[model samples]
Every structure is written in structure tokens, then in C-alpha cells.
Target: MIKLKGIVAAVATVSALGSSAVFAQDVEKVIEARQSFMQLYSFNLGLVGEMAKGNTEYDPEIAASAAQNLLALAKMNNSQMWPEGSSKADAGLDEMTRALPEMWSTFPKVLEKQDALTSALENFATVAGKDLDSLRGGMKAVGDGCKGCHTDFRAKKEEG
Candidate 1:
């Protein structure tokens, strides 16, 4: 059976190759795309984390924007750039992302955590334009969802 990641990857490579134009080699462009996606993800996580932990005063506008931005980034098609013989094989997964192969190996857990995130996002959207306490529970759920996946999948990067 083709794993979901494999399926998504196949499509991404096909799309990227299909959309290609003859041009100079640009590794920078690929890196830039990855960086942009990570920026969107981390930015949203920072906002949500602050709101959840009450570390920073929560504003409805900011909360709503963060929630929506996270959802949008999560939905972006980024499968193709992560090919089998990519740098990870050339180098190593630990040297890059904390995401273990278990993310794909244990797909059900990943899906469950992802579903929790989706629920959190939806709940956040519902209460996003409301007062802080109104959305507090949803924010907690969202953080938990993120941490749950991170705990098992993401590697603890060495702090330099």
C-alpha cells in the first residue's frame, strides 16, 4: 500500500517537474520556499503559544490571524521538495528536522494529532473574534496537539 506521504510526494514531484522551465540551477529558491513555510508555521505557533500560556496579552485580531495563517500554511502543497534521495538520505534527518520517520511510519498517530489540530483550529475560528477567555480552551488544545506530535516526531535540536 502506498503511504499517504508517498502519494503526496509523487504528486509534488510530478507537479514540480511538470511546471519546470529551462533555467539556471537554483538551490536557493528551494531553500527559500522551505524557509518561508517554516516562518509561517513558527510565527503562528509563537502567537498561539503566548495566548495559550497567557505569557502575552491576547488580542482577538492577532489570535484570529495566527489561527488562520497556521491553517493556511498547513494546507500548502509541499510534498515534492522532500524527495527520497533528498539531502536527508545524502546527509541525515536528525541534522535537519526533528520529524522522525515515525511521522509516516505511524501514520495513524500522526493523523490523530493532525485531527486534534484541525479541531483546535476550527474551535479557535469559532471563538477567534471573541474575548480572550472565550478562546482560551481552544488555544490549549492547539498547543497540546502541536506538542504531542513534536514530542514523538521532532528531534530535540542541540542548542548552539
Candidate 2:
């Protein structure tokens, strides 16, 4: 009877370890997805930023296309990419993400910031194709929207 009990205990431990491994994989996937999404945001934003700075020629058609892509990306449903245990504070995820614990803890504040970004992007999309002057005028609000969220929720980058 004692041997049987020991075997059962070992099985349970193995099961627990398996579950933990699966959870870690899930967190990693979520972190990767969110990171990819941010990269998409940056890619689109860079196109417009370059034009605004005159680093790239401002083509109205390309500016409009990029701005529209940014708007679409901002509006994507990405809630699944932010599962509860995927933050930097989670075990094994510290190096996988720069998301602060407060992003989840502060709740509605994050939502508010998200709303601000969506609104700014919508405004940007409307005027982006109009002219260089209009694009320059709208860029500040879009930048501020991004900054507001990063300031409140993202961890400061570690200088390598």
C-alpha cells in the first residue's frame, strides 16, 4: 500500500509540472503576439514619422495607406494577447516582456489610454492624405496618445 501511495504522489507531481510547462508556453506565445503587434504599430507609424520629418518624400497616397494601416491595427481585437500571467512579473516572462504589473492592476486607466490612442489614430487617418501640413498637424496628437500609455504602463527600457 505504501508503494502504491508513493507512485500516486509521483504521478501528481508530474502532472503539476506538465501543467506548469504548458502555462509557460502559453505565456511566451502571448508575449510574442503582443510584441509583434507593437512592431506592426511602429512600422506604420515610422512611415508617417519619416514623412513628417522630411526624411522621406511625403507621397499623399502612401501616407494615407500607412495611416489607414495604423488605424486598422489600433482597432484590432487584441485582448487575447494580454492574458493575465504574461506580464514581466510572471515567472519565466521577465525577459520576454516589458509590460509592467500596473498595466493589469490599474485596469480602466489602461482602457482610457487605449481609447485616447484609437481616437488620435482616427483623427490622423482622416487628415493624413490631405497634405503634408495636415499630416504634421495631426502627428503630435498621435504621438501624445502613444506617450501617455507608455509613461503610465510600460517599464523603462534597460540601456544595454
- Clashes in model 2: which pairs? none
Clashing pairs in 1: 98-154, 98-155
Q: Write the per-residue lDDT of candidate 2 for residues 1-160, one digit (tens) a residue.
A: 9999999999999999999999988888878888899999899999999999999999999999999998998899898888887778878777879998888998878989999999999999999999999999999999999899999888889889
Candidate with top TM-score is 2
Writing each residue's lDDT as its tens digit, candidate 1 over 7-96 gives: 999999987776543211333345456657767778887886677678988888988888787777666667654333223223333454
Which ten contiguous residues of candidate 2 have the minimum total lDDT?
85-94
Model 2 vs. true fold: TM:
0.92
lDDT of 2 at 96: 79
Worst 10 residues of 1 by lDDT: 83-92
What's each prediction's TM-score? 0.63, 0.92
Give each model's clash number: 2, 0
Off by over 4 Å in 2: 1-9
What TM-score should be assigned to candidate 1? Answer: 0.63
